[model samples]
Target: MMRSIFSAIIFLVLTRVVYAIDPRWGQGCTYIDRTEQIYCFGGEPFSENSQQILVYALNITGNSVLDLSEPQWTDIPGDPNGIRPSAASRFTFTGFPGTDTFYIQGGIVCTSCNYNSGFKYSVSSNQWNQTNKNKPVVDASSALVNDILYSFGGQTSPLTGYDQSNTTYRNTVYYINAKTGADGPSVKPQNETQLPPFTWASSMVYSYVYRSLFIFGGKQLSATEVTASMSDITVVSPQTGVYSKWKNIRSTSGSLPPARWGHSTIIDSSNRTVVMFGGCNDSGKAMNDLWLFNLDDAVWSPQETTGTPPTPRCRHSVVVLGKYMLVLFGGNDGTFNSDINVALDMTTWKWTNAPTNILPSDSSPPIDFPNSSSPQGSEGINEGGDSSSNISGGAIAGIVIGSIVGEDSSSLCLRNETDI
Candidate 1:
């Protein structure tokens, strides 16, 4: 099955050259429209000094990969601050139905708490504005349940190193209400709530079966040379409707992913399973193996896919693209985050490397959400049918710069610049 999948991918890339993806894109956020279109928003994958939102269209009508365009750009309205926060780490935006706005959560904030500043982009007007939802600005290891966002284990507001052990922010789990209108839930979840024990680098996700937030592996310190392994389970129910209390998501022993951080956890509705991959281990080991938990049977099973899933790597971004294929982007390999793109065909359990885009040294967007200054790519993500690029990194002494994945992430960060 794996061989067949690999062959199919190779054949498609070779024979069907018409669908090839351009390499000049560098990198940006993604908004995939099933088999029709893939809208890539701006970000910094190049020099970190730029910011502008660029949109690329992957038309699947006549072919697969389509034309790239520089449509209307939103300048983030005003001068929010210095170099845009790297979109690195964890990023997932929830769109409220009735409203034309969506909530962008915890991600790289200029290596500082800058990313802690959430903004709302109007899809209809193509405008950007600041949002009030700015608090626990940690990323890379949080989860979602119901509408409320469950933030646990991951890098804290990089300011004072880790926020754990802090009286106000101890081993805590925060639940952000997803209400978009008035007359919502009364007793809301606050940041003051703490947990029995805390962890960073752990993967948090939503479990439909349990109707709560499910958390996976994580470490003790957010940015440490050493890490404490955790088999401990932690779950947080929303304070709103049908929200459950904090319970151990589940605690199982035996060989797991091997104490690591930067791993990605995805909810696979097609297979009714939760998937995890890639994260540096205790001994600075990165993982490339794929594991799945059967939601129906409550089993933690590592998938024995056929083709070579990328070599054991950590910090790679993975998201459910097609029904069975999960799209994985550049991630850390114990050395640095790569710029390669690959797809995992869940049905056949195979790894398919996608086309690579090469960007010109001079051809850069005003806002780069992907690649940035330090030759360090921060992060990027898809939101509201629009792609947002942010660069996040702990480069500055007191700042965690946003390092985006693609080559041009900074272009998206320069929203207010008259020169982006």
Candidate 2:
């Protein structure tokens, strides 16, 4: 009888240790070099609504460890009555240099409602503070350059009502200072520029080596039709109080990934290359391919990888740790959400799954937000202004087959799915 009880207790302890880890997708992740931790905020479970803000600290003795074991997640405490940003996706999070504060700006609150407000979170205080509320409501591409937050093309809410398909798409540029914590005058910027039409969901990464921002695929729409994927690569350099004109990059080597939005791009300043991965095409099928663009030579090349790659996904968050390691977490696979975390070795172009462990007893549960739903419907660039709806199973099958053949072939037609 004593042996039986001891065995049962051992089993329970083992199960608890294994089950302590929680997986999530669609959350925004950023690495804090000061804390040697990665902060992840706001995600969806199985494509449903979830509001979780947690941090994971690396298990390294010092800064010399090359391979890192998966760190446990700890919930950050927020003020009970203080202002907090509503849970949302497609937002941009930029950490201020030499500080523990990070800023979240412009995201889709609902299928038709995009937010214009900005919020800041201090890692040291574990609190959130509302900043500017008058910023443009955009689900667009943004990058931080020289302590200035620059937001580019995205869609605006329609004045006529909740028409998701007929909203206005913008290529205008706006900037705001990152150090200010108030929402009043300091949040607004006088620097603004109008450019050619560019749609939402594009990805941008600032290259300090080149002193410019590189923009990848986004969609373009008109009253009658939408261009689902864009092939042109645009580079913007911000000058004193203004940004230079958008310059299209001419590729001479390998083919570009099918025009896509909801993808991620990160710059490795040490290698002088921009790494891109996983986004959906017009047909709404997720992708798992990897590609790299050499900034010095202006060449795009497909990366052949080894080991297991994350499943095809879109709207995921990725951060480069140190110079050669890239960590990607959480995303939608078109039909469902993913909680998988994967790491890539840039030197060898190898992929590996991140290790997970049980959470400690001191960890807290994520704070819940009220009245939030799974965000649906694509933002900006609706093809034929169709009503936002889920893609039929038959349409999804066709997309998979089309992707297998070729994105530029006649079999593939640019289509929009419900937004991520």
Predictions in order: lDDT:
0.38, 0.49
Candidate 1 C-alpha error for residue 341, in Å: 1.2
Best by lDDT: 2
TM-scores of all models?
A: 0.57, 0.66
The TM-score between candidate 2 and the true structure equals 0.66
188: Cα error in model 2, Å:
16
Scored against the true structure, residue 242 in model 1 reaches a CA lDDT of: 25
Runs of candidate 1 exceeding 4 Å displacement: 1-46, 50-102, 111-115, 122-125, 144-147, 153-155, 158-170, 177-194, 221-230, 239-254, 270-272, 295-298, 337-339, 354-420
Model 1 / residue 175 / CA error / Å: 3.1
Q: Write the per-residue lDDT of candidate 1 for residues 120-185, one digit (tens) a residue.
A: 443334445544444444443444233343454344444422233331222444434433311122
Backbone Cα, N, C clashes tallied per candidate? 83, 3
| Lowest lDDT block of 10, candidate 2 | 397-406
